[model samples]
Target: MSVEAKNLTFSYEKETVLRDLSIRVPEGEITVFIGANGCGKSTLLRTMARLIQPEKGAVLLSGKSISELKTKEIAKQLSILPQGPTAPEGLTVEQLVKQGRYPHQSWLKQWSPEDETMVENAMEAAAVTSFRNTPVDDLSGGQRQRAWIAMTLAQGADTLLLDEPTTYLDMAHQIDVLDLLHELNEQEGSTIVMVLHDINLACRYADHLVAMQGKSVFAQGRPEDIVTNDMVKQVFHMNCHIAADPIFDTPMVIPYGKGRKPYGAIAAAEAE
Candidate 1:
């Protein structure tokens, strides 16, 4: 299923966060949103996920307005993991993951063998099976993140929306979480959309990239096609060189520091 925004406008109290932004998330692909802080990437993601209602436009899921869908129907097709999600103080990982089965259950069909199987598979996929009995508060940051992802997986939704899934994680943990999501997309053919602060990692993992600037999408395409030094300067307001990543061969951003001049600036100075 695909999610499309139609001239979405959103605000918080008196401040407008997103303005007339429209974008389509391709089905069965990983799409990453990248931009400077407060650039509306997260707001746009939230609006797409139906966590926030748009002030002016609508979000369509699989060609149907999400606002018109039943809540349980929407949950069966899409799952969202918001930034910094917290659980009850004493909730175990297993307990938390099982909660994802709520959408699949009704008064007449409370629990089924399929639910048990899904919960186990999700835990195994996220590599949190061993911590099933552990209190979520006891796990390290990365482990907790994985456990939360397992919960989302247990929802059995084809589309996953994550906002800054790597926040508060160390470098290795960041890659670990992102790699897990990549594997999920490759193996399950799921549509994964996420907001990422690390541009390099976004380029490395994203099959499609959306760069937001000034409350709208500045560019949208494959990272190799859309990410450039000029694009970086435009979105981030910084001087940078775009290079091919040695590992992933994707676009890598190398920023210029306050005391350093970009190679272009240096060359221009020498030409004077």
Candidate 2:
């Protein structure tokens, strides 16, 4: 599925969060949005999800305007996993995953084997199958996050949007979740778009990278094409050395201090 935003603008009360923003997420690929805080990343994401309407432009799903599609119909075409999800007290993992089937069901078409199989597959894919009977509130942060992702997966949508999906996860769990997301994109050909805080991680995982600065797209391309030191300095206002990662050969950043070097190197050299 393809998501295209054309001249989108969003405002809350009197403040504008996104202004004249336009982006086209590659179809059937993982695209990561990276930007400084309050740079309108989440706002743009919500607008694309149809959670918030744009005042100026439209977000198109496939070829149709998302607003023109019925809410349930849109849910079937795309699903979003917000930054944080709250489950009702005592809700089981199975119950939470089953909720994803709501858009696919009606009074006349209650539960079916298809729904059961989808839920089971989602749980297994997220590695949350063992926690199916466990209450959502009882799971750890990572496990709970996985359960939420599983629910989104069960929606069976062609496109998935996630906001800060790695938040609250330790380093290991962060990679774990990202790896799972990559696997989903590879295997199911789902269009995955997300906002990520870690630029290096985004480069490592994203098939396409979109960098935003001051409510506009600073750059968009493959990681190697967009993640240069100049882009980092322009967007983040920090000096950094960009190098190729030994592992993935992606761009890696090494930050420098303000007019200083490690261990007072200048002072030590003067003494010598």
Against the reference, the lDDT scores of all candidates come to 0.93, 0.90
Q: Which ten residues in a row have the lowest lDDT in candidate 2?
A: 261-270
TM-score quality measure for candidate 2? 0.94
Query: Could you give candidate 2's per-residue lDDT for residues 222-270 as a string of tens digits?
Result: 9998887689988887767777889999988776745754345534643
Off by over 4 Å in 1: 263-272
lDDT of 1: 0.93
Give one digit per residue, the lDDT tens place, for model 1 in 1-272.
88999999998988989989999998999999999999999888888878889999999988999999999999999999999999999999999999989999998998999999999999999999998999999999999999999999999999999999999999999999999999999999999999999999999999999999988989999999999878998899887777789988999998874467766655465357
Error of 1 at 264 (Å): 11
Give the clashing pairs for model 1. Answer: none
